[model samples]
Target: FFGDYPREMREMLSSNLPKFTSEEKRLLQNKADFIGVNHYTAIYAKDCISSPCDIKTYEGNAMVQAVGERDGVAIGRPTAFHGYYDVPEGMELIVRYVNQRYKNTPVYITENG
Candidate 1:
């Protein structure tokens, strides 16, 4: 649950979090009946807020540095595309997360192999 601020998010991105206007917040409430999730693979997450990361990326906004491997072991089966892995379990986890976060909203797997 989120209030004016999310505890976990605020712990990493304090002032970086955007302030939403009342109109925007109102518009966002129950805006979608279904949620579409585009999942590729799972990875190891590092707290870039506490440590250093080489490349700044979209995930960096959440202060998470994602890597495909840990301790020389890959997170999942490597795919032909770089950074994309074949991790079927990730799909289940992501969908479950969406269901919980979106109050069991109908979910569509928008993108997958």
Candidate 2:
């Protein structure tokens, strides 16, 4: 399972403790019959260059603990693909990258529209 980017890090400790990810790759090496990857949407992470957030700064959404607001709308620099927005080449690149890294691993991508 590729839990690469946890939407919000405020789970238990850090604000975006993106768990699993490469961790599972090591932990479940031969433990499971089928290796699964659940990737639907990608996200951009914005680490605080400062400290813990105050009450007003966090607002009511615990998910977005200390993000910024522009024109009264909360936003972050999404971890989206560099070119997927305009072309499908991004998908090809991802496949090529994955192949180069995991040369012999059986692969499956369980995604939906």
TM-scores of the candidates are 0.76, 0.30
- What is each predicted model's overall lDDT from 0 to 1? 0.79, 0.43
> For residues 1-113, what per-residue lDDT tens digits would candidate 2 score against the true structure?
23343334345345435345566757745444433343433332343334344444333434233334444543333335431222234345555666665566665655521
Stretches of model 1 off by over 4 angstroms after superposition = 1-5, 11-14, 57-62
- Residue 72 of model 1 has an lDDT of 92
Question: RMSD to the native, candidate 2?
Answer: 9.7
Looking at candidate 1, what is the lDDT of residue 7? Answer: 75
Q: Which ten residues in a row are the worst by lDDT in model 2?
A: 82-91
Best by lDDT, which number? Answer: 1
Taking the candidates one at a time, how many backbone clashes does each contain?
Answer: 0, 6
